[model samples]
Target chain A: MDRNGLEKQCLEVRRLIVKSVYEAGSGHPGGSLSGVELLTTLFENFLKFDPKNPKSDSRDYFILSKGHCAPLLYSIMAFKGYFPVEELKTLRKLGSRLQGHPDALKLPGIEVSTGSLGQGFGVAAGIALSLKIDKKVNKVYALLGDGELQEGTVWETAMAASHFKLDNFCAVIDSNKFQIDGSVETVMGVEPIKQKFESFGWECVQINGHDLKQVDEAYQAFLSHKSGKPFLIVADTLKGKGVSFMENTEKFHGKAPSPEEFEKAMIELGEKAL
Target chain B: MKKYLALREIYGQKLVELGKNDENIFVMDADLSGSTRTVLFKNQFPDRHFNMGIAECNMLLFAAGAAISGKTVFASSFAMFETGRAWEIIRNTIAHDNLNVKIVSTHAGISVGEDGYSHQANEDIALMRAIPNMQVLCPADALETGAMIEYAAETKGPMYIRLSRETFPVLFQEESYSFTPNQAKVLKDGKDVTLIACGRMVDFALEASHKLEDEKISVRVLNASSIKPMDSEAIIESARKTKLIITCEEHSIIGGLGSAVIELLSDSYPVKVIRMGLKDVFGQSGKPQELFKFYELSTEDIIKTVKENLQ
Candidate 1:
């Protein structure tokens, strides 16, 4: 799809995130909304996953290292026909496969269970290593939050991925600046993120995350990376990309939109809540 | 009985055998391959081994990823770091997903000796057992450790096998000895009292049983190697037959074999139980035997406890 068509689909996902969080009365809408385009583009364009057979051998794998953004992952998977789109409304509800965090056992496309920060990245690297060892050509992708980078395990995984020369692995940091408490820099600075990954021997790329074309180019560079190194894309993103009130706001990081606020969010995204 | 054999040595040797036979078997260690004895597999199958370089947390997650991707994975580190430091990662990724990953940790319990309290993993059993769907195994000696490595690879889902650093007398040197998950091996048969033990402490329990026989107090000994899915039927039968039970291990008395025995009996059939091991305290720098004596895990301690708690 072109950039314009991708943007429309991104808005649809953003609307789904808002509606699910609103119905569940709890979720990280801010971070979930920020990662819409990143996840949207990957699932729609780059990811080679089978909706019929989620665990097929000839398919690629993706892990959500910043697992609190389950709303976005579930929305994308549901929209892609992995499951019924109506299941998105059951987010965080009791006895639902759409858990608060991605559960690999409960859901098919989820390759790793990653509620704890920095863990999924290592798992992603492990899958990449396995694919390399098996001589398979499947690419492994992982999404990490800017605040989640504060975890030491993330750096450990970064160093290991590059040391192993996992060219099949690509990690993108949803650098949305804000965490639950405040700005990621004020809380715990992880600036010079690209240089950090570069020093770790990864091919680093920086792009405006909200721009679909830039996101596509970043993945393109990732695909072309064959300098005997892993790939890292540091995409600068807004905390809330689509909805006006929630953007760049920390209060919406983990709060569910009220019924009235949900109506406004749906209206802004050109959708109606059921 | 043959001279004592280091559990880690047998573990390392069995890993090589397992690796040679199954190409799907992969080994990982956190720069402690030499100490954990995963170096044997690393030497044999260099490409199949991953030296994770002192990163236990990431090593576990990596193992989970590989195991889920259809590889039989064995990850090793000291019990303290592998089970204590990276417990949540193990719980979330391996246990929650029910992935086929075997976390066989070495240097468990105060048997870590001169490394002192910091290196000892006194609470590893408790930490592993608390996780839902995790199978906890503690091999009694070198023979059982070898058998367990084979069984662990064959058995599916998340499993933890705890091994000690110090070499102890071989208990399962008999030709008929076989290791089975959740099954207690009755090493001695008597009726006055039943002695239940796991890990290296099983040898001490056998010693205690013989010494008690001289005093005309017959004792039955059960090697409770499978800690998590405990041999509850055997425990319940022993509770009924002997009417008194004594549990021993190298771990803390609070949550090791003793706790498992008491927990089972309290639910099914209650009996008078005496728990023996480290008494809720950290160990100091000492030789393995000296620490065992200091912590009252020696055979003399078991004999003493048996005498005191006997009917």
Candidate 2:
């Protein structure tokens, strides 16, 4: 798909994100919306996953390390035909496979179950190591929240990934800046994120997370990396990028949009208010 | 004089043998390869073994990932760190997903000795048993450890094989010994009283039974190695047969084999039960034998408990 087509998909996914969270009555819409373009562009172009055979051994693995953004992941996964797009309505509902957090056992295409933050990245690094040992070229990708970097295990994984020279592993930090408590800067700063990853021996690049072209180029660079080190893409994104009222606010970090706010969010995302 | 062997050393040798046959067998250690003896496997299959540094959480999560990729992974660390520090990771990631990761940890119980309370893992069995889809095993001797490791590799899903830092007297013969999960081994049968024990304490229980025999008291000994899917049938049978039971371990009295036997017998068949272990206390720096005597987990302690309970 061209950049223009990918942008349209992003809009559609953003709409789905709002709708899913709206229907579920609660979710992290801000972080979910922030990761739209990064995930949209990756799924459409970079990620080598098959919708038909979701468990194919040859396929690339994608782990939502920041599992609170399940709304976005579920939307994109649904859009990419892993499951029925209409089933997005079942988000966090009883007996629904769309759990509150990403459960790999309960859902196809989820490589690792990740709700207790920092665990998915560790699992991702391990998968990368496994693939490396088996001499397979399967790439492992993990998307982490900026606030999630506060976990010690993330750094532990980062060090191991680089120490093991896992060039096949790529990690992206969805740096939307707002956590539930407030701004990430105030709630234990993870700034100098690029430098920190670099110090940990990761080949890193910073980009505007919501920019499809930039996200595409960053992934391309990771693909072409010859540093013999793991890759880290520090994406500078906006909390609730597509929506107007919810953008840059911590209120929507976890709270669901009210009926009126949901209508406004849909209108802003170029979708009919349900 | 009985010959004693270290369970961790047997574990390392058995893992190397298993790795030689199965190409997909992988070993991981959290920087304690020397202490845990995974270094032996690392020496042979350097490509398949991973030294995951001192991060137990990362090591377990990594083991889960490796297992997810269809590799049988044996991850090792001290029991305290493996089960305590990385407990939630084991519960949520490994056990919850039912991954094929065998966590064979050493330095379990007060028998860790010299390392003090910080290194001892008196609650590992309890922690592992509480998790769904997790099978907990505490081997009685070198042969059982080797057999349990073999079983863990062949079996699917998460398993925690607890090992002690101290060497134990070998009880089972190599040709005759067979490991079956949830089945207790009857080392001796008597009508007066029953002694159910796990790990190194099994040897002590046998000695206690022999001492009681000299005193004209009949005693039965059951090695309750499989802790999670506990030998409920053997426990109930003993409760019905002997009417008095004493459970012993080198772990805390709160939740190891003692608690497991009591939980099973209390529900299925009620009997007079006395638990002999570290009664909710931390271990200090001492030799394994000294720690056992100081903590009152010695064979003499078992004999005294049986005599007191019988009277």
Candidate 3:
């Protein structure tokens, strides 16, 4: 699809993020709304998965290391025909298939269970390593939170991926500035992120996360990478991109909007309020 | 009549044989392949072996990734790193998903001599047993170690098998012995008192029973190897029959074999139970035998504890 069509899909995903988190009455809207375009670009263009046969051995795998952004993944996967789009309403409810965290056992189209910080990144690297052992050319991709990088396991697995030269593996740091308490820098600085991955023997790319054209081109370059090193894309993103009231603030990092605030967010996202 | 063998050596040899028969068997080590004896499998099947460097947490999750994708993966390291350091990763990825990964950890307990308390893993049994759907196994001798390895491969879901670094006297004959999961093997039987032990401490229990026999005190020695889904019926029956019970192991008495036995009998049939092993103390740097003696886990310690409790 072209840039105009992909941008439309991103708008729909952002609208769904506001609706789902508002209905559930608790979630991280900041990260979920911020990851809309990256999730749209990956699922719509790059990821190789059959919604019906999610357990297919040959399909490309994706892991959400910042799993609190489950809304972006769930909405995009529903659009890809993984499940009925209407079922997205039951998210975080009792007996709902959409768990608060992505549980691979309960939900289809999810490659692995991921909720704890920095764990899914390691799992994705391992999956990439397994593919190399089997001599399969399939790729593994993961989206990590900038705040989640504070976890030591992330760096450990990062070193393992480079040491093994997992060229088929690719990761994107959703470099949204705000975390739970405040800015990622003030809470615990993880600056020089690009140089860190480069020093670890990874080919690094910087991109405008909200721009669909840049997101598409970065992934295209990742596919053609021949450096025998894993790829890391540090995409600069807004913590709350579509919703004006919540934009660039830590207050909405984990808070659900009120009914009146939900109306304004739906209007800003160009969707009808309930 | 008896041969001494290192459990790690037997595990290394059995793994190589198991790998030859099953192409899907993958071995991962956290740079401890040489000590854990996974190096044997690495030498034979270089393509299937993965040296995950010194990252035990990532190695376990990596093994889970392989296991979920139709592979029987064995991840190895010292007990401290495998169970202590990477416990949450094991619980969430391996145990929660119920993946078919065999976490075989060696150098357990004070048997990891000269490495000090940091290298010893006395709390691994407690740590693993607390997780849901995790099966914990501690084999008594070399024969049982090989059998348990094969059994773990055949069984589905996650398993934690503990092995010691020091050599232990073989208690079972090669052709005659068999392993049944969650079942206790009655090595010897008598009526006066019951002696239950696991891992390297089983040999001491046997020797202690022989020394007690001269005093006309008949002792029953049961090899309680399976720790998690323990032999509750055997323990309850022994409690009813003998009325006196003594539990032994090379690990801490707080949460090892002794704790399992007491937990079982206290509910069903309460009896006078004496636990003989390391108390609430970490092991120090010493030879395996010297450490065992210092911790009061030798044959003399077992005999002394039993005789004191018998009166």
Candidate 4:
């Protein structure tokens, strides 16, 4: 896929996310928009997933460690044919399989159940190690929020991964610079994320998360370099990338779009998105 | 009933045996290998053993993830650290998802000794049993513990087995003993009353039954170790036969074995239940026997409670 095509797909995903979250009435929009391009490229082109046989032994595993961005993941998975697009509207409702958090047990295409921050990487690392034990070559990909770096377990597992030299494991840090509370700088100060990961013995790559070619090239670049260490791609992203009103805005961190504001947000993410 | 074996030892042996038989079985620990007895498994099957340093949450989450992808995983750690510190990971990754993870925690109950309140896991059973689709087991002796460990490993979905640091006597005959998961064991027969207990308290219940027998009070003794399922059949039948119940354990009265028995029998059979356990108080550093006695989990306490309930 070319740069413009990837960019257009990312924008279309953002539009779908906005529309779904708006219809659902109670879904995360801020972090979802922030990670638009990163998720788009990974699920669209990078990941080796067969949606029809989601738990195929040969298929690559994708775990959203930053699971609060369920709306974004659900939108992408629905587009990828894991479930019906209509099920997106029932998110957060009592009987909806689309729970407030990502439940892998109830939903297909979700490799692990996640929502609690920092814990996802530990689970992802295990999956990677298990694949190694099985002598399987399927790569393990985990996408995490930068603010989630505040968790101590992330570093513990990071050090363990480095110590194990799990080159098959790949992690993407969506550096949206904002948490549920405020700016990442103010809330937990996980800056120099690339340096931190590198210090833990990971071969690090820093790139603009909005740039699809850069993201794909970086992922491919990391994959090619079998340096006996895991890869951590620190993608610099806006908190709310696509929508003008929500970009880098701390207020939308967890707030669901109101009924009145939903149309305008949808209009911005309409058929002709950025 | 003097010479006893710690359940952790039994779990460690069982893990090594299972690991040797199945290459897919991976054992993950959180640096407390000495206490949890996972070191035995590690030494036996070095290739499949993973030590995650002092990170309990990582150990648990990693185990669940490994289980999801074809590894029959057993995660071992000290109960206090695993249940007290890494609760969220166990809640979300293992139990909430209902993953095929057998979580075995040693140093359970006040019998963990000198470790004091911070190290002893007095509430792990309650913490794990509350989760949906989760099985809770606390075996009384090494024989029962061994059987429970095998049952947990073979069973599907998530399971939490609370093992002990304090070794109680191996009371049952291994040749004749069999543990049915989620089923209560009816050890002794009586018509006047039923004495239900689990883990360390099983010995006390048996002793109390003997003491009461001398007093001409025929009290039935039950090893209701499966805390979550609570052995409704045994509880119901015993309740019908005896019309009174006396439950004991080495945990809190609020959510441990005593509470479980009451919860099971509240609707139909509202019999009088005398609970003998730590009276909603934290434990302090002391000898295992001293602590057990102080918490009223001793044979004397059980006997007294049984007599009081009979009246």
| Second chain alone, TM-score for each candidate | 0.98, 0.98, 0.98, 0.97
Which residue pairs overlap in candidate 2's backbone? none
Model 2 docking grade: high
For residues B1-311, what per-residue lDDT tens digits would candidate 3 score against the true structure?
A: 67899999999999999998999899999999999999999999999999999989989878877876678999999999999999999998889888889999999999899989999999899889889999999999999999999999889999999999988898899889999999998888989899999999889999999999998989999999999899999988888889999999888888878998998898899999998878988999999999989999999998888888877
RMSD to the hidden true structure, all candidates: 1.1, 1.1, 1.5, 1.8
Q: Worst 10-residue stretch by lDDT in candidate 3 chain B?
A: B61-70
User: Chain A of candidate 4: what's the TM-score?
Assistant: 0.96
- Model 1: DockQ against the native? 0.83
Model 1: per-residue Cα lDDT over B103-154, one tens digit each: 9999999889999999999989999998999999998888889999999999
User: For candidate 3, lDDT tens digit of each residue in A175-221?
Assistant: 99889999999999998889999999999999899999899988999
Candidates by DockQ, descending order: 1, 2, 4, 3
On residues A1-274, what C-alpha lDDT tens digit does candidate 4 reach at each position? Answer: 6777777777778887777776666667899998988888888887999999998988998899999999889988988899998898788888888988899878988888889998789888988888887778999999999999999999988998887788899999999999888998997798899998999999999999988778889889877987989999999999988778888888788877776566667777665322
Better of 3 and 4 by lDDT: 3
A80: Cα error in model 3, Å: 2.1
TM-score of chain B of 3: 0.98
**Model 3 ranges with Cα > 4 A deviation:** none
Interface RMSD of each: 0.8, 0.7, 1.1, 1.0
* Highest-scoring model, DockQ: 1
Name the better of 2 and 3 by DockQ: 2
The alpha-carbon lDDT assigned to residue B100 of candidate 4 equals 82
For residues B1-311, what per-residue lDDT tens digits would candidate 2 score against the true structure? 89999999999999999999999999999999999999999999999999989899999989988988889999999999999999999999999999999999999998888889999888888888889998999999999999999999899989999998888888999888999988898999999999999998999999989988999999999999998898888889999999999999888888778888888887889889999988988889888899999999899998888888888
